[model samples]
Target: MSMADRIKTKLTERFHPLLLEVIDDSHRHHGHAGWQEGGETHFRVRIATRDFDGLSRVAQHRAVMSELDDELKERVHALNIEVIPADKA
Candidate 1:
């Protein structure tokens, strides 16, 4: 599966987010470090879920990063995350 698809699937399974948007920002970073010819190196993930309701920003980012550990280690170079609470979604 594509990196975006994998991110969506993992976040959906783990958080059951009310809203999730995985955007590939690689094209915007073209020619910069970590930018591959075919892209898929940079991403922005916006997710809203009750799971993140009580977590601090750092904790929320850690949780998301933990869920995507393999992808981060193997493929993804930069990951920007926005974790919103379900009520604020």
Candidate 2:
């Protein structure tokens, strides 16, 4: 699967989001750190899930980072995440 798809899959399985968008933004960073010809190094994830409701923003981000730890270590160089509580979506 593509990195964005993998991220979407993992997030879906874990968060069961009301809204989710995993965007591959690697193309925007050409020639910058971690950029490559094929472009799977950077991403932006916008998600809304009940699971995030009570969490502070920092906690929410940390939770997502932890969930995608392997991807970060393996290939993904940067991830921009915007999390929303389902009710707020």
Candidate 3:
């Protein structure tokens, strides 16, 4: 499966988010550091889950990063995360 698909699956299994979007933003970083020839090196994840309700922004990011640790250690270079607020959800 693609990295995006894998990421989405992981988040779904962990958070059961109200909203989730795992976007492959690799193409936009072409020729930059860690930009591989085939892409899948960077991502933007937008998610909203009750699991993140009381966490600070940094904690929210840490939670998602922890879930995606394997991917980060492998090929993913960057992860831009947006943890949507309850009001937004």
Candidate 4:
């Protein structure tokens, strides 16, 4: 499966987020370092879930990084994440 699909599936299974958007921004970074020919190196994830409501910003990012550890190490080169609370979404 694609990297985005993997991210969506993993996050959905783990958090049951109220909203999740996995955007592949690799195309925009073409020719930059770690930009592969077929893309899938950079991503932007917008996630809103009650699970993150009480966490600090760093904790929230860590939680997500933990979930996507394999992707980060294996394929994705850059990840920009926006973690929002369900109430705000």
**Which pairs clash in model 2?**
none
Better of 2 and 3 by lDDT: 3
Winner on TM-score between 2 and 4 is 4
TM-score of 2: 0.95
Model 1 C-alpha lDDT per residue in residues 1-89, reported as the tens digit of each score = 99999999999999999999999999999999988888899999999999888889999999999999999998799999988778988
TM-scores across all candidates?
A: 0.96, 0.95, 0.97, 0.97
Residue pairs in candidate 1 whose N, alpha carbon or C atoms collide under 3 angstroms: none
Q: Residues 1-89, candidate 3, lDDT per residue (tens digit)?
A: 99999999999999999999899999999999999999999999999999998889999999999999999999999999999985688
Considering lDDT, which of the candidate structures 2 and 4 is the better prediction for this target? 4
lDDT of each: 0.94, 0.92, 0.95, 0.95
Compared with the true structure, the alpha-carbon lDDT of candidate 4 equals 0.95
Model 3: CA > 4 A from native: none
CA-RMSD of model 3: 0.7
As a TM-score, model 1 comes out at 0.96
Tens-digit lDDT track of model 4 for 48-83: 999988899999999999999999999999999999
lDDT of 2 by residue, 1-89 (tens): 88888999999999899999999999999999988789999999999999988899999999899999999998899999998668878
